[model samples]
Target: MKLVVQEFLTLDGVSQGPGAPDEDTSDGFTRGGWFVPFVDEEFMEIVDGWLAQADGLLLGRRTYENFARDWPAMTDHPNGAIMNGLPKYVATQSLTEAHWDPTTILAGNIVAEVDALKRQPGRELQIHGSARLAQSLLAAGLVDQLRLAIAPVVVGRGRRLFPEGSTPAGLRPVSQHTTKAGLSVHVFDTAGLPSYGIYEG
Candidate 1:
């Protein structure tokens, strides 16, 4: 299975809270719901397509708890079934059991566990909104694909996807498109370490 990381980010690369205002206020992050304005049916259709391609979901502790709390109640939505039924792996040491149906808790070494998971036969093992976990995988050179829905707004402060001095990565663009509400969705395949050279003008 190819390890895929899908994220929602602001123009300034903040990935903290794209859903609701109270969704994630950790470290006093008040810039929540910034991505809401750019979401339309077109974007949702694209998201549904993404959810369809996932054979299973890999989530961090926080993200897993958040989804486990809400997805069951969203059973009426078009994407709810996929969200609820897909096999889920939660990377956490604290959680002894996950109430979410079909969830496996990875309390051991996350990288090794995910590495083993990637070797299994499947389409895509998706990491959805698990930014911290995604960062770890990317740093370890384990992420296979990256799909980001970038909103056209700058959140002056929040947890960013790529902070200063982050591990460098190379991404090759596969496809891109715009939504009706001005969101840019870009898909890329990881290209190992980035190529470095001096440009002689």
Candidate 2:
């Protein structure tokens, strides 16, 4: 199974809370729902295509709990059925009882556990809004592809997708498109470790 990360970000790379006002207010993040204005048919089509190819979900505790609470009840949503039904693998040590059905907790050595998941036979093990988990995967070089919908807004401060001190890696853009709402949707393939060089001009 290939591990793919799909995320919505602000112009400044903030991925903290793009869904709702109270989606993720951790650390006093007041700029939630920054991606709401960029929603359109093109955006939905792109997102739906990604979700359609998901064989399972790899999520962090916060995202898991949030989705488990909301998605299951949103039968009317376009992607609710898939979100509720797909197998979810959560990385956490504190979650004793996962109320969501078909949830597997990865307690020890998340990188190893996810590595095993990638070896499994499946379409794609997708990671949604699990910023912390995404970072860990990225550091371990476990993510195969990344699909980012970059909104044209800057939320000054929030949990960013690519933060300071993150492992540097080379990425090749496989595809890119601009939505009617001015969102830049890009798909990039991980191109191994980054290389350094100094240009003399």
| The best candidate in terms of lDDT | 1
Measured on C-alpha atoms, candidate 2 has an lDDT of 0.93
TM-score, each model?
0.98, 0.97
The C-alpha stretches of model 2 lying farther than 4 A from their native spots are: none
Instruction: Give the Cα lDDT of each candidate.
Output: 0.94, 0.93
Model 2 RMSD in angstroms: 1.1
lDDT of 2 by residue, 1-201 (tens): 999999999999999999988999999988799999999998899889898999999999999999898888999997887888999999999998888988999999999999999999999999998988999899899999999999999989999999999999899989999999999999999999877899998
TM-score of 2: 0.97
Per-residue error at 115 for model 2, in Å?
0.7
Please, what are the lDDT tens digits per residue for candidate 1 over residues 8-61? 999899999899999999999887999998889999989989888999999999
183: Cα error in model 2, Å: 0.6
